[model samples]
Target: MHIAFVSLETVHHRDTETNRRLRTICELLRDAGHDVHVFCAPHWGGDHPQFEQDGITYHAIAESTDARSGVAFRLPIALARAKPDVIHVTATPPGQVAPAAVGAMLARTPLVLEWYGDGGVFPHRWRRWAAGRADRLHVPSELVATWIREQGLSGDSIETVPNPIDLERIRSVDPGEEVDVVYARRLDEGANLESLFLGLAELRRKDWTATVIGDGPEREAYEQLASDLRIRDRITFRGECSREERIAVYRGAHVFAQTAEHCVFPTEMCWALASGCVGIVEYHVDSSAHELVEGLDRGFRTTSEAELADAIVEAGDLERLDYDETFAEYDRSEILDRYLVQYRTLQDEQGLL
Candidate 1:
């Protein structure tokens, strides 16, 4: 089978969870004996318009200042050239839907749009209409699927495929020296890091230390907040770590704290849990972290700042359990197999098989 993946950018240049997942899926599919091709803007180097890495081909679509329009204009030409059996597109904003839908149509290929369920902004009616043009939709969680239905898309066309976790890489690391707590996420406004800082201030009575891992626009403000709270001495802000560094931090921490206002299966938190850190999430209206850790023994969901502090304290006393059993369903192999099934099903339905 030939599969074409359309995205604006991928992990080939940027270090984001979405791009990393896209790279992983492409590699896995190629490993399974499928011909995989990626159609993306030339994010890394300008020298090569096309290149091959890890048995998958990447075709660089010319980029313009207006990237959305640029990709929309160029993707159909690339799709026609690749002539893939199926088209899989990553839809971040609803705008990408137009190019992907049109490109797949031009190629006469079945289209599957994977929605990461981030970006709290809702799509405009026209964007939703463009999305409705796809043959099927793949979302990371049921919450997202529900949102899609509310937008008037058929529920039957939506499939919930959780992001894949590389358990093998997580399992290879040994637990480092222990720390009291760890918070890993973008330090942006939506992350609600101030709440975590306040919760940490409450833990002053207990001898505890925290490591905040991640960088974003709010880093300076968050650091200043820690100072104002006088907990700055006890907290270390390690901005944007490498993959190994992140895993090491998770391995060293006793508690993993999440206070995001909205999350769709946070990959960092999952890595923390898989690294044996006890999970604690501050409940938000649309958070999926609660769902991920709900039934697990080493997980806690807090509704208030007080509860978050208490959960952090409670987590310190708990022994780290083997998350392999708890997170088995998210194994990369299993996720790849699920995608293969979906691909085959769509192909058969369209009589392309």
Candidate 2:
């Protein structure tokens, strides 16, 4: 199958979660022996019409990245010429979606828009229209799916597909230094690190060390809080670790705590769970982190510092593992299969299968 991905700005232009997700999907399809083509504004040096990297071809739709109108005008023609079986686009810069819709119609292809719930400065109405334009809309979680429905789209139009992770890497990397607890996220105000810090403070009498992975503006304040709790020495702050570095810590640690006030999807929590860490997630009204661990034996959901602390202690009684195969379902290959299933369903609906 030949899949055409439409995005005005890609990971090369801006390293956003949505862009990364788009790139990952394209590469997954490419590796699975499917023809993958990405139509976007030029990012490579020079005025090249097309650039091939990692077995996927990127077609430059516009010369300048800021030329939104130019991209909108040219994308449909480019995609029509490519004549892909399916057209996949990100739900950002909502302007791109309308043009992609035209392209899909011109090429007689099924249009699928993936809404990660992250969009640039665009009108709410534009987002709604973008939602309406797709034959099938994909979201990362049920939370985002609810948002999509609120846009007045039918339930059948929206599908929830999660971000993929590399499980093989989790099994290959050696565990880092042994630790009792692990917490990871950008150390921002929304991080809500105080929950974990206060919980750890309650267990001051216990002999356990933790590793905090990530860096941000709130790092200093969090460190001060840890010091005030007098457990600063027991916590190691490894700032902004690479994926491999984080997997090492998650594999070595016994429990992974997530206290973020808001999370569209608890990706790190998923990673930690896949790496064999007992997940301890603090329930928040806006956070969807609990979705990953709810009703699972390997997870504990808490509402307060006391509960969090107790959950941590209880996690120790559970069996310790270096790697959990249960999460293999979220691996890239598995995610690719889920996507392929959707593509085939769309094709069959369009009488192209």
Candidate 3:
């Protein structure tokens, strides 16, 4: 199968969740012996109109990275000429979806839109138009799928395909030194580390230590909050550790707390849960973190600091595990199979099978 991925900005231009997810899907397609090509503004060196890297080919639709309108103008022709079996486009610049749809129609190919719902602010009309244009929409979580439905798209057109986790790596890596509780994420204003800090502060009399596993502008503020709570010495700040490092910490920790103010999907919390840490997520109006713990016995969802602290303490009663098989459904192979299934379904609907 030939798959064409349309995104004005590639991961080479800037690293973003939407770009990374598109790249991952394209690379996975390439690895599975499918012909994959990425159409985007030039992110490669030299004057080449096309560049092949890793297993996939990237076609430069515009010379400048900032030339979104130029890219949009050229994409329809480029995509039609590429003549892929299916066209997968990112909704980063929602304006480009209409052009990509034109190309797909011209090429008589299925058009699938990847909308993570985390892409920076765009007009609601643009999102609604993009949702309406694509034959199918791929979202990372049910939360995002709901958002798409709110855009007036039918639930039938939206599919929830989650982010893939490397289960093999989680199995192979050894656990790092243990901590009673762990919280990991960029410590930005939206981090909401205060929820966990207050929860921990409530347990000052208890004999438990915690670890914070990320860094950002708000790290100092978070640390100072811990100090002011008088539990600074009990909390270790290991900012921005590698994947393995994080997995090890998760393996060692008994509970993983997620309190972010906003999240399309609680990816870090998912990782921690897969590593055997009992998940404790705080509910936020804008966050979908609690979705991971809804029906699971190994996790808890809390609505306040008191509930979070109680959940953390209750999590101690569960057996400590180094790894859990429940999340194996989210492994790379499983996710890749899901994508292939979606692609085949789209092809069948188009009578191209």
- Cα-based lDDT for every prediction: 0.80, 0.88, 0.86
By lDDT rank, best first, the candidates go 2, 3, 1
How many residue-pair clashes does candidate 2 contain?
0
User: What TM-scores do the predictions have?
Assistant: 0.87, 0.95, 0.96
**Residue 88 in model 1: lDDT:** 91
Question: 1 or 3: which has the higher lDDT?
Answer: 3
Cα miss at 245, model 1 (Å)? 1.9
On a 0 to 1 TM-score scale, where does candidate 1 land against the true structure?
A: 0.87
Output the worst ten-in-a-row residue range by lDDT, candidate 1.
118-127
Model 3 poorest 10 in a row by lDDT? 120-129
Between candidates 1 and 2, the TM-score winner: 2
lDDT of 1 at 274: 82
> Which tens-of-lDDT digit does each residue in 242-266 have in candidate 1?
8878887887888888889888777
Give Cα distance to truth, residue 57, candidate 1, Å.
2.0
Candidate 1 lDDT at 171 equals 73
Best lDDT among the predictions, by candidate number:
2
